[model samples]
Target: MKNFTRVLLAALLVASFAATAQDEESPALSISGSVDAYYRVNLNGTNDERTGGTIAPGTSFANKTGFALGMANLIVGLDGEKTGFVADLAFGPRGTDAVFGSTTASSSIVNQLYAYWNVSDAVTLTVGNFNTFLGYEVISPTANFNYSTSYMFSYGPFSHSGLKADMAFGDFSVMLGVFNPTDLTDFNPTGRYLGGVQLGYGGVYLNFLFDDDFFQADLTAGWDLGESFYLGVNATTASDSFYGGALYLQNSFSDDFSLGLRGEYFSDQGVGAITFEENVIDLTLSANYSIGNLTIIPEIRTDIYSADEVIEDADGIDVSGDPINPTYGSNLSSFTIAAVYAF
Candidate 1:
């Protein structure tokens, strides 16, 4: 049934685009998507039970023939001399969250909708749904070197529905926007109305987003050392009604055929009921030899959580700390092997 719906929608979108196309001879309409297939073997047994910053059922690593429509995005893009429009839609298994209280999965909807109007050669105005410009991590799995989204990315605001403006100055570009503060929250709470700013140049980036009760700022930088090797780092600080001011850092090392390492640490400054004043560390390293269109990527990653105190209920079980044992599995780890494509 779901597969049938997806096919139907795809056809409908194409049909609408064709019917509305004025020139019929212009080559401005482009439709594209990708296929990501993989096998992920989680060492934590099938019933290990999840207790951290994730949307899986248990703590165990998950292994399967994975395919998700949400991971694949479709965009109806129309480009002209100075104006462009895009209506983005998504569908598939790897959707952001499962229905609350039920393990059943959720599908997709219109994730991004916006238009770009260039006022001058160095500036443009955009109004609609787009990715936030703060974190080094992104929600799209294929856009990332790894399949898992970072705690920082998942923890921070995902997307905002609003209007924005952008400007280019020599080697850098600056973006600022206002959003309705509402987001696609797994069909739960209505988001907060907020705004943010992003500036980027030469692989270095910085962003700031704020609302009635939350304020966050992050910085990122990346470097390529030639010889198939690269390194990147991200740092963030924020304070919210639920959690106090906190600091974090994440880093990555990548090479052609050998290894990659990732690590992140977070500390609290006094805010939420629990404060989430815990430290988490994670790592992933992989190796592969590529030939033409395919390459095999086998990787391993872990999560470690720690705190001075672990709160508990009357039963002597950790009821106050995060669901994932921030302090154990080397503290926590998952492994995978996947083949991705680029064109």
Candidate 2:
């Protein structure tokens, strides 16, 4: 009888342990990503690089002529009740251009890798490399309505590696972070660091980033005008660098079709050249057609500069032996068609 009682007690203890384990929520793992490709053509310049310069705009992505691969992104995530981690990886030309500051081969493919802890219902802390919160556009093609990036986004910081805290209060939210200098995503070799702050209410965000040598202030907002029409606005000014404003107007015709227009006015403050001061205006129109997880974008873009000779023309050289490749008028135009698939 004593032996049977001991055996019964051991079984009961095991059962209780199993029941507790079943009641606790298990960590969930998820995988998702996107792939993109595009074809582009110059409207006023040579399509090839035989003239010693590419005819695309000065923006970040979708600049290559003919057919090109954008990137393949893979994001893996694991979430628990109070902790989570994300590993985002990318490959191809667009990804390489985006993560240009990553020095090592292993770090080059990593777009974002971070771990977060939920300190409370309204507060969270995250550490590691993550995308900057100041921009209206992101590095991911699937997220932006336009295939090509804006000059403000191209000049702003891409990613930051640091510690940040996000807190929320009703409709208001605040984020504060200390990071390595702009685009230094792997580690901080320079002793200087960057600080950032973002304040949000409703859908509008006011962001600021500052360091010893750089300071930028940005405003981003979005609104829905009707059942099918939406508008987005972004404006930024970086000290001694660049200042620009862009407006995004989009109308959805159906569940699978939408049209978007972006208009921008940008000014360069001799960032590219010692004596160059130019103001530029860009207008882009695009159509989005969605089928399941795939989206097709057809776009047309035109840029006008304040000064002549801003863009390279098809003409090769002048009679004075000076290169006329970049000696055309103040305007440049191009067309692009892109396909993006997400899952």
Candidate 3:
């Protein structure tokens, strides 16, 4: 027993020394990441998904009843007081392509890889692939509050590759980037990364991206009304390729209980100049009660689509209204309820 204890101590000492050596070799490097999983059944789909049972659409339970859909990210960063660098890797099931044997479109591997070097307290330069500055929500599900993404979030400019820079002072920062267009497979462009900027101060933020083929602009702001009530508003307008934006408000009466309501209006111009008008107003409310390690979350949501929004023909699908192969514009009104847990 004494010999075993000595051996264990020696192993621990070696690990400590290795870690020290690593720290000395890269004094600025740090690693951090997060994983999130949820079981969600969409009641808006069909009876097959909404069957009333344990984790059904309308039940209250600790475990969500659905497939394990989630996201994970690993961020490797380096810092040296005023200067810093970051590389992020993203992966999950929701974004995989069905042709690759995935239920949904989830890409595999390090899709988002970028490096930024801070040159001064007020400015920094970045290169590689990164997310575009355009939405209220992001691609990372672990960082989002809702299980399903909004219409605006699904169709916005995703990312860019090339030279980017950010300037910061006080509570406001301005970012500008140029990227190469890589079609649908990637965010960076083949010749340029496009060009974009975000300007914000206090509770408000605005972003703009302009390219030879397209231009996009978004305005967003949030107000925290005292203890638990807050209001958030955002709007987006883009040239023919994308259409999505929402204005909403959220409130929390207590630590374990909260509610949210939002009104959304959207429209999209698909690839090759096919246009679809989308206007909708959605109402969603959710309640959560926590007990120790278990949390009971019940949510209710409703959506109403505008009359002029549905399309009868789309080239991507052979006759758009056909249910056998409906495109993204076929259904405008859909609702969902889910219960989730964290372990």
lDDT of 2: 0.84
- The lDDT per prediction is 0.52, 0.84, 0.52
State which candidate has the highest lDDT: 2
Error of 2 at 129 (Å): 0.3
Clashes found in each candidate (C-alpha, N, C closer than 3 A) = 23, 0, 15
Instruction: Give a tens-digit lDDT track for model 2, residues 200-315.
Output: 99999999988667789999999999999999999999996888899999999999999999999988886662122378788999999999999999999998878766666656
* Better-scoring candidate (lDDT), 2 or 3: 2
Candidate 1 vs 2: which has more lDDT: 2
Task: Give the winner by TM-score.
Answer: 2
Tens-place lDDT per residue, model 3, 207-263, is 886656677789888888878887777788777655655766777777776666655
State in Å the error of residue 5, model 2.
64
Where is model 3 poorest over a 10-residue stretch in terms of lDDT?
53-62
What TM-score does prediction 3 earn? 0.67
TM-score to true structure, per model: 0.67, 0.88, 0.67
Regions more than 4 Å wrong, model 1: 1-27, 44-70, 96-107, 182-192, 241-258, 268-277, 287-295, 307-330
Tell me the lDDT of candidate 1.
0.52
